[model samples]
Target: MAGGNFMHRVLSYVINEVVVNGLANSPAFQRFAVRTSKTLEDISVKASKKRQELAEQIKEASRNFDSFKN
Candidate 1:
């Protein structure tokens, strides 16, 4: 039982080391990060634009409502 536990820990450590090294050395991962970051930035900009449009629409609607009430 103790041997099994020791083997499990060793395998886990080796796997984690390999994965860390692989990621660190991978250009593909770096490119992926850059692409994902750019995509997120684009989405954020679009969202801000949409929010502004909605705000303007709401203001217009409010003005219309006020005039109706008057």
Candidate 2:
């Protein structure tokens, strides 16, 4: 168990070190960061539009129900 734990820690450390070095010095990582940010922004916009459409649908349903009650 202890040996496994030691190996896991060493692997984590190495991965973290590599990521830090890459972010600081790698042009590829820079492009990756930009692309990731743009993708996230696109996702956000699509989510917002879907939310608005759902809200409108709920409002229409509520209005129809109110009209039927009268």
Candidate number achieving the greatest TM-score relative to the actual structure: 1
Cα displacement (angstroms), candidate 2, residue 42, comes to: 0.6
lDDT of 2 by residue, 1-70 (tens): 9999999999999999998997979898899999999999999999999999999999999999999999
Clashes per candidate (backbone, < 3 Å): 0, 0
What TM-score should be assigned to candidate 1? 0.74
Q: Model 1, 14-44: lDDT tens per residue?
A: 9999999998889999899899999999999
Instruction: Spell out the clash pairs found in candidate 1.
Output: none
Model 1, total clashes: 0
Error of 2 at 26 (Å): 0.8
